[model samples]
Target: MRLFSTSARLLFNNAETKQMRAQLDETLKLFKEKVSKIKSDTSVTTDKYKNIAVDLGNGNTTELKQISTIALRGNNINIVAFDPKQVKRMQTALIQKLGVSATLSPHNTQTLLVPVQTMTGERRAQQDQLMKKLYEQLRNDARDRNSISSIRQKYLQPVRKRMQKKEGESKPELKKESEAIEKLVREYQDKLTDLYKKQ
Candidate 1:
């Protein structure tokens, strides 16, 4: 089950990264299975780090750039949200998807959590929702692009076949020209034979 929660415990609680990891090997394996590419939170690579989709239950995700820490929680994951409102949304998501029993307070940050409300909240929420929607849209576009590629391949296959047929049809004429050139060379000391050999 791809269950999830969020906490900044990685930032706080001084959780031994390896101790936490050692405690949760099975969970790690499950995530490795779902996401094709997994980057260690601390490791540096030559390529740009592309965001990955972790299936937090009920279609919630840690796709946002604001996710600062990812901790294992039971069979789920705790995404330490850098955005304050995202902290609340994480709680709400867990409660809705799993149960009220599943809801857990985010790891308290030394950094303040400013409670956004009213107009500001609406705008931020819209932005977050749009980000999620945009992720989905991009995925759909990739799928569609693959379909278009296949369709293009399907249409182009016939054209390729026709070109191959034309090439085949001209092969005998090419051979005849080669043979006639050879005959001419045999009949007369021809410069054309030298050109043919050079060609």
Candidate 2:
């Protein structure tokens, strides 16, 4: 004699699987959003330069765009500060952050002239390292948020409780359900790994 009729078992399995998949889909959506944010933050372009934080020398920091207008010239980027007093400080900040020297434009005292340099092999390697670090952080965060143990506690525990099963009892169907959840977890983990490699 079976504990549940075939139809009853099917309905239970379907409901539990649907619930688990919905959770997984929500997690995947959040993971993609984080990946998008990382890409936006790490982009190497004029917009990124404009967003770089500059120390204001009064124990405060502000973005370059807050005080200056950015313009691109042939082989150079011109950062013209709104305040003449901010020009020197802005130049120092740019030099430190960009690892390149900058000069005050002779034509405009408030303008800092920064020469554009191509990404060298060393710089490319450094960027790769940064991307690796960011990806690792994202993976760790995802794991913390959706670990197998936590999922079992949140989802499987309820099913076990409703079945009137003792915590120590090893039910075959529940075991199979756990394995299925493990497979789902692995699928999402592989997706994250693939995304990082493409970055």
Candidate 3:
């Protein structure tokens, strides 16, 4: 029983050691690959970085010339440059690496002007639309006034007959009501005229 227990412990220790060694080997291999690349880069004497210009699909060029710092970690390179060009290039490279197909291009002034002209035309159309709406409102108001006057005339017929029959009827009250209605109708007509003149 003692021998069996000792053998079991040894087997467990061996397996643990093997797992740790495998992990160490993998880590060392990665480290060596990174070091090899760094050594090559150091020998290459990379150029003193200047402006980076990236042409965008929108026909715009972005340039970045100023650099602040550069850092490398393993296989990754970090460049800190405020130049727009550098940023664009790096972004493009990264996208390409990731298998993105979209490419940046330049923007054209003529293309931009096309949209501007279209917007101006749209604005003019809107203005014309507003004017037409105003004219319609004026016409509707005038029509409404005419219709009201017609209704008032129908309703006042009986009242006018009764007032005529009354010998004491002052007639001034009926005259005043008629004058008020006439004034309102005149105002509506004037509004219609103003709307027409505006065009």
Candidate 4:
């Protein structure tokens, strides 16, 4: 069953795949009966099962129910083992039974495959609003930068230039005042950038 779950794509061709799915649909009626043998009536198995068969003519099947979560695309399969330890067990079983190697996908993302048409209109609207806000923030940041630059040029830069031009006795005092004006500009720039990051 593990081998079938892993390599249903490679093992079964187009015709077999279709036959297998049809057989699974037929067997779904007997799911309650089959599952009863493995799990007693006391244990609750409320979870929905997705079962796929590898063979239809032979009546040999791969069951996914009670073991792992399975998502099947045309030839692609995604399995999430309920027990992490079962992963190694499945790999070993596949290798020993079929003599074919299996590669497990790395778990970097927690994305799960779901049915189509699950998205709501509200969710779409929220995404659209978020993008709009982001673009507005970027535009405001640019405008604020220009305004800050203009303000520095208009009020602060001229005073700094005058202070810098003074090359006589009070040159040290003038330089100190000029440095303070530059510091204020830098602080304002930092504050604006911080606000941009928040947005």
Q: lDDT per residue, candidate 2, 92-163, as tens digits? A: 788788776779899989888888755567666766676676556544543454533345456656656745
Error of 4 at 185 (Å): 1.2
Ranking by TM-score: 2, 4, 3, 1
Q: By lDDT, is 1 or 2 better? A: 2
Which candidate number has the best lDDT?
2
Number of the candidate with higher lDDT, 2 or 4? 2
RMSD of 4: 29.1
TM-score of 4: 0.26
The per-residue C-alpha lDDT of model 2 at residue 67 equals 96
Instruction: Give one clash count per candidate, in the order shown.
Output: 1, 0, 14, 0
Report, for every candidate in turn, its global Cα lDDT versus the true structure.
0.36, 0.68, 0.40, 0.43
Q: Give each model a TM-score.
A: 0.20, 0.52, 0.25, 0.26
RMSD (Cα, Å) for all candidates, in order, is: 28.7, 6.1, 39.0, 29.1
Q: How accurate locally is residue 199 in candidate 1, as Cα lDDT from 0 to 100? A: 19
Query: Candidate 4, after superposition: displacement of residue 132 in Å?
Result: 12
User: Which residue pairs clash in candidate 1?
Assistant: 5-78
- Per-residue lDDT of 189 in model 3: 48
Q: Against the true structure, candidate 3 has what lDDT?
A: 0.40
Q: Give the least accurate 10-residue stretch of model 1, judged by summed lDDT.
A: 41-50
